[model samples]
Target chain A: MSFTRPDGRGNEDKRPLHIIYERLDRVDGSARFGFGDTKALASVSGPIEVRLAAEQPSKATFDVTVRPLSSLPGTESKALATSLRGLLSPSLILSRNPRTLLQLVVQSLTPSPIESYPPSLAAACINASSLALLNAGSIPMTGVVCAAGVALFRSTTEEDIPALVLDPSESESREAVGCGCFAFLFRTEIAGSQPLPTNDTPGARLVWTNWHVKDGTSDDGELARAQALGLAGAETIWRAIKQSVPQMDNLPPPPLPSRSTAGELGIITQSDEVSDQDMNDAKIEI
Target chain B: MALQTQTGTSTDLNAQIFQRLHPRAYLERFIKEDIRPDGREATEWRDLSVHVGSISTANGSALVRLGDTTVICGVKAEIAEPDLERPKEGFLVPNIDLPALCGPRFKPGPPSEEAQVLSDRLASTITAAGVLPLSALCIHPERAVWVLYVDATCINYDGNVFDAALIAMVAALKNTTLPTATFNEETGRTMCSRKLRKPLPLECLPVSYTFGVFDGTTVLADPAAFEEPLLDTSISIVLDEGGALLSAGQLGIADKDTMSMCVSAAKERLETYGREIYAFLE
Candidate 1:
């Protein structure tokens, strides 16, 4: 039950995906992401002293969890957690903060036989974790953006697949067997570098691509199509992550400094509603 | 807020905070002038801007800004067994939270009374408005139902938090367009499909209007924190689109006459404020 494509995309192609980042004041760092059909929410806490016996010395410990959206964990989540641990642990710069723990919990939202797999969800989870770390004032990789899944769906009964499908729903995933995930990192970069100078470039174009399946079916046409869809997914995730990240940065300024009077913190009650003028007029000391 | 909690809930503490913050006299004057010092007529309201699909993670979400106030509302819906009592309906739970970081008064802990009160009010309003078509959420009546969690957060509190929160919440609900869920009669398993059905079953649009009473005589529409002082009482009116009132209440010291004044003030504001916001939403 495999779908074949000449160049993964035909005409009017799109990569379906959703990304969300919410602050969990309960945890040090947290974010939730849904790529194409796969969804995950990740929380990162600590840089504090490592607490577990399995903690690594001279470095920080990285913990990963993949909680599926629809069902309990199986082979998929474990594989995702293992793969994510490998990809993210090295990027943590753990030596900078030794004997600490960096926990990452990835909660996958979409669960089914056909939807985006855990691999792509893990990549997005890592990206979200990185962003959460940045929100927590922890500097990880240069920057982060979510990743999405792109699949080439062709009915087994027919030779020609439908138009290039972006992010397919669970039903779409079930119809197609050939699917993969793309990881995108969003960092604005100058067009030209010393080694890859942009002599042909006029203005700057911030490239947006991070990771994709390194090896698979070797058909040239199918490979091109998959790459193109991956690029499109990268662009889509970049736009969404870009929009969400700004709000995280635009936090309101800390509340006005307050002073305690009568050597005690005043108990505020319903009757304690103070006028704006009083908030300004009252003379108190912290 | 923490300060208030630290002090006992004795009438003295309540009186002190109320005296310092919400003075009855100030609100009375604003009501009397039929205008707020901020240059708004008694019926005028602050401008509003709403942006939807702002939060990527949530299934449906929106960010609404009214004057200096900002509220973020997100919807996360999940499938679960239906309640034994009401098997034919889905759930739409609305929760409002004000982070301590938003203001000095907000405390860090469980939701405050203000948050709980606002959530309950919004939840009831939404239910009455028929924002969620219960049948759409019903899966075989007593079998399964979709539980929607609507979380509204006040990131910034300028004034009239309730009005702003309501706007954001309804806007977010309006902005949300969900895909259809196909229930296979044979397998009995539900699958989400891209073929979107109709928008969430919405019956009517309801928004809340707040009136601040200062000086025991003045009726101030949408009072800011500064004018909150010298306020004698406050009123919040919930109305439908046809200029009909659904629910109205006063939140402080106000006589029956003052209450009538507050209602009239709220009605007038709804005529203008309602149209502008409703236009943005529709």
Candidate 2:
């Protein structure tokens, strides 16, 4: 190969990943993600009152802005936001809230040259933002998922065949003509409990937030590999979502009418069930 | 105590009630005694402690406390072309902010005038005084120089912001170590890291002391939060350990006589503050 990375791993393999949640307090949800050298912080706020006129009626809008701390827009931030918006919107039940707006703000603190599937750092950003949304008690979605992209390109010369790149670094992406990205939304479900009614479990529904790739070159065979990678990525992220929303395990029971009414009081008298005092005692002992 | 329906203090109200109800009077009394009802001096600064190397990841960092005023200062340096006008010198940019959460009066937004003026003043004074050796910053002369960003933040405020900020900034610069840069002929790029052993070329430590002159008479050093609103005049002095004044200027309203008196007082204040700075080294 004319260009080989210092590390022996093929261009398709990703760098190691580190994901963090609840990085900021003022925002509804926030996260900081690092993939090798690249670092990104993502925060989400509001299904609150719509401050913008364009976002109203029949849809919960997604507003995303990427800020690069050191330099102006690099190739990675814009591509990451566009792909993340597509992947994340599907996971949100935005159609239910006609006029509400959900805001996503991602800041790239440090730019790393690493490129591979899902752009691990960007994926971390989205994941963190989604968790922040959950923390804010926004209505939940059906499942949680994240996405990544891979590119495959061929050289004009026959001797040098097409190459499969997992995630192309900024330099490499510019050099190649062919590129492909996958926006995967993993289905999220509470691990220990059956699916509850939407009204009861507001934080349980799955909402996809992040997509990342570490490093790779794009070649003809990239799609098949990315799809395969997507499935595994979805499973891992599903596990993460379940871990993030642990409150689903002990949901409050639907509120029941008290015996303040005469008719209800009679029913309470007739029943031989344990008294409130007994329940309180049991709770204290436990 | 009689409950008054009116929103403000009634002149006839009892002294106890008047003291309790009048924020303005409470502030005035606090300034008069140079001592808070809680027994702290108006000019008497709060207990100041400095922690160096707080930001382990940063090139140089320090956390400073002046009474209740808490500030964090971090120094980050990057290599770039020197400004065309000042090719022989490195660049220093100071950013000071009163993040909205710090006080109710501050609105959430961009830098306020107060913050802008402080940062600009600090930057200009340090540069004009030749505190940091600008010549040392020149890597390729006209082609490249180092830009040092001094990010200073006020985490908390009780009063006397300038002194706290200056202390934090100086401690951060003192704690800072330079980065190593190597030119790679193959790539024609210079890789930079925090491995350099040499200290940044420094000329002298410029220490700042701030005093508030109230009613054109009381020159209070390190005015607390309550005094800031009551005071009529304020001044900050940046000086070296050698007792040579580098920068002396006043804010708000004060006559030349009062200003000069405050300046002399500030000279004494710097000696006291300088002792604290030296102690931190130990």
Candidate 3:
């Protein structure tokens, strides 16, 4: 059989990402994030009075609800709510708005026909909700946290070794026996350090994860590799998110870093030293 | 605590009641004495009884009681156009109802997660078993065919509801009689004659056996969900009379030996109670 992804993208490549920041005026904050054909829009409304039944005693209550692309909500949607709520609870600097409620709604626009059975739209949901929460600007976060989706791919060769794919398209995700979603925080770096998302930032945290593979299958090695790739992909998206926000034109640029570590790390920023090769790497990686 | 009216979670309120009511610890103690609390061997099945053709309105109906669990399955057959993709085949739809009457845990609303899972499992098992040849229900090529709707309701919740549902479904299908249908070319409709009933083509018997691993090593046959819902491992296996595996569902990592033991026991049940389970159909 011919070795070709259904979307004709490389196994290691992520789908084209498009982010529409502050897309809705009515909501406190809103955004639309799309990875290939799967699109999700999220809106945040909160710092409002908490209902007695749903109140939190100490911290602001974070509620995440996912409405699927088609059909009424089912067990899968309920499960997604649980996972999203868990992730947002720790990420959302809720201590600032104690005795309040933060409601986030993520609406998936398309169902995955590519991964036909028991489809999941987790990656899209997380990204859109994160963007909306940031746009809301109601709560101060310690760091910018984002999520990335990764899948394990096997080659067509006689010896099929698993390869990791970041932000896999629906069809590419279909080929993966196992996949996971990873969330990480991008913390501010030292003036001349590695990059904005160096591997060991004090605040760089993994806030959420959901990973699974076929039962009784020996895919532990594959899962570990996929998780590592997922973290890298999350960093790439974190950089892209920072770049997407309208930059500070008035503030003086930080003194050109004594060393060009950002250029070598494939990050595109206000720094004028970004090389074409670095730009290409940034484009393809994110 | 009252055995019949006593509901779940209310047990939490009645702590002293649970001490006397639940024999789980007592059962474990009995195992040390080389006996089950119910006075049976580890592999011994609970007493089961089946009554077929009990519902007057349904074409086929059966009520099954295993130990304390009770399930009633009713199969209704109607003439309908066959699907375009499988014109020669009919259809079978299985739905399981977990109503509040069965227990306090189930609420009155849409189908619960447990119900949906059981419905899908029973449907897949029926399809894998080839319980009825779709071609046998065809009338006038693709114009009309018999569609069987098998619905099971849990009236009592003692335990092993899946086993009771599967047995009731098989019994109900066996009791079902196909009505005579003649296709008319003029109206493109089927005319049915209920009096001229005929038996459906049932070639093989598909049965399920459930086993639960208690305390990791001790395995109990037909374990009750009420007493021990969480276990180290729980497996349900469905097999046909031909010794071919039909369908299987497992919750946890069951040891290799435990799986094989359950399979061997299920095969034996296919010959013993599996065949005797249909005695009421005649």
Winning model by DockQ: 3
Interface Cα RMSD per model, in Å?
29.7, 27.6, 10.9
| Model 2: lDDT of residue A240 | 39
Task: Tell me the TM-score of model 3.
Answer: 0.53
CA displacement after TM-score superposition, residue B22 of candidate 3 (Å): 8.6
Task: Judging by TM-score, tell me the better candidate of 1 and 3.
Answer: 3
Q: Over 4 Å off in model 2, which ranges? A: A1-286, B1-21, B31-34, B184-187
lDDT of 2 by residue, A94-186 (tens): 887777778888776655432222244455555555555555566557555543334444555656655556544444544544343333444
| Candidate 2 docking classification | incorrect
Q: Is the docking of candidate 1 incorrect, acceptable, medium or high quality?
A: incorrect
Candidate 2 - chain A - TM = 0.58
When just chain B is superposed on the true chain B, each candidate scores a TM-score of: 0.81, 0.84, 0.87
Output the TM-score of candidate 2. 0.45
Per-residue lDDT tens digits for candidate 1, residues B222-273, read 7676665445455676666665554444443344455445546656666655
Rate residue A103 of model 1 by lDDT: 74
lDDT of 3 by residue, B1-282 (tens): 354355443545464454466656545556677666556787888899989888999999999999989999999887788889789888787788999999877899998866776676566556545677778888877788888899999999878898899989988988988778899999998888858989777866666888877776888888875445644556676766555555444443344356557667777776676766765466
lDDT of 2 at B221: 77
| Predicted candidate 1 versus true structure: per-residue lDDT over A143-235, tens digit per residue | 444444455554536765433455544445444444444443344344566543211212111111111221122233453455456556555
